[model samples]
Target: MMSDDLFETRDSSSREVFTRYNREDRIKKASEKVRQLHDPDFIRKRSFIKSVTENRGLRSVFFVIVVLVSINIAFFVTRSDKNNGRIYGIKTELKSFIYQDRALANLRLSENTKFLESLKESEEKDGALVRVNFIFLDDKGTKLSSSLQTGIYMGTELRFSSQDESGNAKKVQAEIYIKEKLLVLSSKIK
Candidate 1:
């Protein structure tokens, strides 16, 4: 009779065991749904981090691009500053030459002062030839206060000038032809 009672208890506990298993399964499914909803972007962020960490070549490419861009900016800034510094030297030399030529022109009055003729009339052996035309007008067509025409030849030996204000060249322009081609165009500023 005890064996029959044991069989009855075992049959009853089976139902309770099933109920506990169902409760645990429900709790696990609910936790999984909550995780998916709360951390929707977790998968994408993990994939991105893994890809960057594993690919050495991609990381190196990014580093090289940054280094090259920085170097390019530094080189450009230094080169531009150097070019600006050279302009001051050119301006000072040009001003001194103009002042010296003006003072000397006051002494020579007998020479026929026409204008700077073509380079064909003169020869440039040293290759440094500057033909200056006494510009009488500005960019707005305003006349300058002084008028003088001189050409810097080779190393400052040959110069041409006009006889007087009336005989001076008009619309003065200096053309620096290199190898017989027009390379630079300069005008005298009074």
Candidate 2:
């Protein structure tokens, strides 16, 4: 009976020690979990990362839109208009004779005014003449025009003057037409 009591006491003490150890392990696990949940640095880092990912998607979309818009604008700006005809070169020059005689100048001035009035009527019927050299080449044929009477084929230099309704020398422009369609337009200001 004494041996049986001693065995019972040993078993009871061993069970008590196991139970105490199990309780301590459970407390440690719960506290570790709580600590992890309440950590300020970890929470802040997680929230900041989550916010950045959300905003990054929106920012990336915005950046792509901006880049596409910029590309379209550049393309349109660089593209040339095909409707308006091409102009190669424009040149203008003015020449005037000087007279020193006062009485002769006064007599000539009145006559010049009368001549200018007559010239104005004729100018209204025709577009202003511009000294130009134009060449048009296509599958149909080659057409050329120039200020020189010999035409552009001979490659001769020429000059022409244009006048406004007031008989004053002014800017001149001309449009070349083929089959009622504008081929080229050129102008010169003097």
Candidate 3:
């Protein structure tokens, strides 16, 4: 019992001494800071901590502006195509029609579009079968919309024979809607 009392007394006294030492150290540092704050030379001197506090707002504002601008530039760059101007925004560019076939590799895309234009009307009048495909791009040439391999037909859809070419058969038999992403909505309907 006596040893326990001694231990308690020692622990309490040690804790009191430790706290008093910390208090004295803190008081000394605070007085030094107060003296520096009053000194013209210290005020004029540019220290790392001083500069950080003085330009805190400027630094944060500049960083925010830079980040916003970088995001805007990235968005515009990602939404653009080589052959076209701004897309996925305003309709600055007209809609463009592209043609593809088994022999598509033989000719360039421009050549195929030209070829399709000439043949499209003739084939339509003759009631020949034509195929159309679309790709929805997200941005940065990173993500391409893909059709699921459902069965024999890719991007498969069921249609009624009676309703085939039924919507705009008299005017135009084709429709390729891609929001405002292309130039030239479609070849001018004859």
lDDT of 1 by residue, 36-98 (tens): 555647553356546665678977876788899999999976532111111101211121123
Cα lDDT tens digits for candidate 3, 49-103:
5675577796787678889999999987774433323222222212322233110
lDDT of 2 by residue, 34-75 (tens): 656655565533564455457778668767888999999999
Worst 10 contiguous positions by lDDT, candidate 1:
83-92
- Regions of model 3 farther than 4 Å from truth: 1-54, 81-93, 96-190
Error of 1 at 169 (Å): 28
The models' CA-based lDDT, in order, is: 0.37, 0.33, 0.32
Ranking by lDDT: 1, 2, 3
Candidate 1 displacement at residue 95 in angstroms: 16
* Candidate 2, residue 11: lDDT: 54
Candidate achieving higher TM-score, 2 or 3:
2
Q: Which residue pairs clash within candidate 2?
A: none
Model 1 CA deviation exceeding 4 Å by range: 1-54, 81-190
